[model samples]
Target: MSTSDFVETSYCLVFSNDKLRANIDTLLDRKGWRKEWEEYQGKLYLTVTAPFDLLAEEAERVKLEKKLNTQANSMARFHFSKFTHYRGYKNKMTFFSPAEQARLIWSALEDTPYSKNDFGRGVLPKFNDQFPFCTAMKSAPAFGLEDSYPLHSPWGKRRFNSNVSFRLVNLDHAVRDYFGEEVAFYFVWMLFFAKWLLIPGVLGLALYLFRPEGVTVDNSPYIPLYSLCVPIWGVFFVKFWKRHMNAVAFEWNAHDFEEEEELRPEFWGEKRISPVTGKIEVFFPEWKRYTRYFVSFLVMLPMLGIALGAMCLSLNLNNYIRDEESPLYIGTLAVFAQPGGIFAGDSPYYGYLVPTIAHSVVISILNTVYRSIAFRSTNFENHRTVEEWEKSFIVKRVIFEAFDCYLALFYIAFYRFDVVALRNELVGLFWGDELRRVGVEVIMPLLTMMFQRKRTTRKMRAEKKASNEKPIELSQAVLDAPLEEYDSFDDYLEMVIQFGYITLFASAFPLCSIISVGFVLVETMTDSLKLLYLYRRPRSRRAGGIGVWYSVMYFMVIASILTNCFILGFSSEQLMQWMPNMFKHEGGDQQFKLGYGRYVVGMVFTLEHILILLALVIEHFIPSCPRSVTTEMARRKHLAKQWLAEHEADASQQKTVQKTEHVE
Candidate 1:
């Protein structure tokens, strides 16, 4: 091996400040680092681990040289990077030189530029070596985690590299549009959801605790309403939040970025469309092209229907199941309600569609408000070509609503139903809405699409974002267009059908669950296939699928809570009315006493919190850099260019080797 062989390829993440370092412990998975201090320049430096192959490449070197990206964007060495390659482990990262790394040692700590991203107060991740504030990683990649790029670090101050995926929303550099800071909107969303959950839940408790052990009619009618409220909260909060998302965009990024600077504001906080006509309004100029001025639906009509439908559905299902023998067995179920386990006269309150109207109308109003405002603003900003505008408004609306469906699914997936609702709604949820059944059938998949649309089309001025071809629209067109224009609908349908069949490979435990799962597989695949193969490609495009992961959370929640509900309800092992009942029954009874409801509640809350925290932690601790390796290579080009420039110039009139820029 040559002299270079002794220098292990260490990939150091360059930081402009301690802010990045503070987040790194929680944000990264691999743990090896060396922070070097520059004695002469008074700058701080860090050396990270990498395979040798990546280090030797000049492209990689220059890329890694820019640490922490604060050095001006125009500056050469101020960003995050990759450096070095290992000769032995071609599969791993290459790193930087070692002697240069020793400078981070405590004895050597002196004046050097340091990271603002870090705070010394928090926990430090275990790593191999420590040098004053800088250190070497203690461990390599976790098993099967090497490919995790930009692994999450436990460091907390919110680095871009952290696993949390947040949209900038609508930042316009000209004003304050910080969505996170919108306390009023958050309060409304929280209050509305709480209202639905709490009212009924409180009633349930009042009924449960204060009734003096009622033999009277279980006037727990509030249960279904409460159950219905969870989904309503899910839907309304999504729509309501989005209604103000533009405001967030303005507050957060308006100072830093202007998505559209074409339409300057006449006033500090307002825009003037017709100074002559006096049209002064605040709107999301980006979506103006896609917003239609007027589209109204009968708001309360569906709500009355939905509420009645749900109540009736519950009452009817109760009647239907009354005489019928339930071949019900205990098993884990999805977040949405479905039935199994023999219970006397248990109702499958399957018609959650009643609450559907409540949520949908609220959502429609929110959508309408924004659409009306944006459409009127079209007089001010030409966000899109007129022809494109005609095709865009509906696409945008459908995408939002549909994508909301997905976000709802995500909440349902992760949280047990009651937690997703107000604390009081758990009973009505289990008894009346049969949310599990309704969700599995109507909500989960709806939510899946909701998220899918959200992912694909979540960009600002989304309709005009040119790189994206609208799959939602194209799929719609393919189905609704003339047969002469496209001939392969059959083949398209077949592929989607196959997708459904493939999904069905994972079936449920019981015949009903198996059937329901199979049904869902077909429904999801067929609906997708129809979208892809059936109507004029929906003029609407999906924002894409940000909701998919959340949908998975809903699935998990449903799976867990349903399991708990099922096992408790079905097992011969339920708690009795009293301790004496357990011993005195002709057959032993393992009945649960009512006092344990709090424990059940605790379990669900802990489960939900831990899961979210786990994800947050994973994202924070595992250091998977978001940008591709190519971006890193681009940063390395400067160093290599200088080295080559000196290499060629050295031969001029007997130049010394010391004149070259290759310091190593």
Candidate 2:
């Protein structure tokens, strides 16, 4: 929990061969090696001081308590490492090491603080023990070798090999092993660069170029070179990562999908009312009918939060804003965003910033947290299909996201002290009370809907069976169709832009947003109220899609840019005193001058930062999407299921003939 706990608790042990002990002593004498050595089973092993000893020991004890086999316990039993997966700063005092990942399961059996008995069954109750711990050494010799064996104990190799359970292996000799010595060297090098080179390197050059105390002025030559290559380093990292994912999918044969996408509970409690007529009426249960509506309502929650914050800002600005003469700025941060934006005082853009930032950050956190919760229990037994894999992703994350976003609006509404005369006690009483009820009442049903959406699919199959139409079994039908191909620019627009935007939460004014009254307020309330009485539970989309968070920055960049221009271009009564500082502190004339150091940072922040954001948005606007790999697999799987059914029927018929022959 604290730095002291991490440092004080010694976990690792060190031992070596009698011959090696002296060598090690000489090697590590300067490196702060403490504690004594021990001999076991005629082997001189150095019990190096490691943090993972406690984890490994605890994991083993839990395994014995659960009565789980050695293998299972080993996979689950674990401890953390001193080094971090990321770079540029000191490693966290505690973090996961691959060696300890396997022992984590056994740790669970011991009723450890981190143990969760109900992982896959509830939100994520099932824990799998198949992932190997092979990546402990980045420069693993066992990697890419058929007969190569691990040198460290089995636990030491669990980190990288854990992905081996996912079956992502690269056997190609043309490219070097991903974790080979050279690759490892590069990996460390890049991390060091990411931490130190990118941000600090750029800053150093700027400081040197625009030094208040003149040292050397060589900023111009390296400017383009630095700007260009930093991105190149980033690009190589991205490509390398893609290969990493592909390798995992290949090794595990996980590319094949397991579950069809569905609204599982949508057709629950269906009724056939028409007996005499050829057409039969099926009544959808309450939640099934309003699936889209419910999803749309949830989608609009952030907007509702925005509206709430805006109103409070407006009210505050109405009374507090004393400035006059608005500036002509570009986007969300113009005069409209201030306290007065909602009323007559400031521009309307003032109230939008905080909610925008909050929304983006919340979405990112929700995207990652629930996904990990879902991912915690994956193993060979449970990870048979893509749906199972995504189960953790959808169920765990959606619930948390619903609660977090729901509460955001609640906080703003509760704290907005717009009352003319407020008794301190009753200023804001019931901000998120209704949302808290909704979160409790509806979350379970929504989560259940994820696994049980087949209610409708089965209902439809039954109807087809009874009627003249041939029955289309859902298991066979869902994966039977292929995605339509894209054609021209019109098709691209139709498929990617309009189709993508409307169905997903696409922004109307990306460069400049203006969610005005009338529909916005109505939608906000409609969305909020809908959270209570949903017809169907919606599946989780890529809630933390790069598009959404990037848009926030895009919004901020535009806002900041507009704010800069407003201050620089216009002579506002309020900001004129501050605006003078952005440029060099001018003489009596009060104008910007060339050759000043202020130009270095102020120029880059206002000019380069804005351009970078805009360019990134433009690059992202090409409208790409995941390949329809899931669609293809579903179709193939449907055909496979149908084939299997035919085979089983034929086998049954053959058995009957054999029995008849025997009787004769």
Candidate 1 C-alpha lDDT tens digits along 56-135:
34223223222222232222321112211112233222222121121111112211223323424223332212212332
Candidate 2, residues 388-474, lDDT tens digits: the string is 444433433444443443233222222321111111111111112223223433465455444344554665667677897987544
Error of model 1, residue 358, in angstroms: 20
Those runs of model 2 whose alpha carbons end farther than 4 Å from true positions after fitting are 1-240, 251-291, 298-303, 306-664
Index of the highest-TM-score prediction: 1
Alpha-carbon RMSD of each model:
24.3, 26.1
TM-score of every model?
Answer: 0.26, 0.25
Off by over 4 Å in 1: 1-305, 320-533, 538-590, 593-615, 622-664
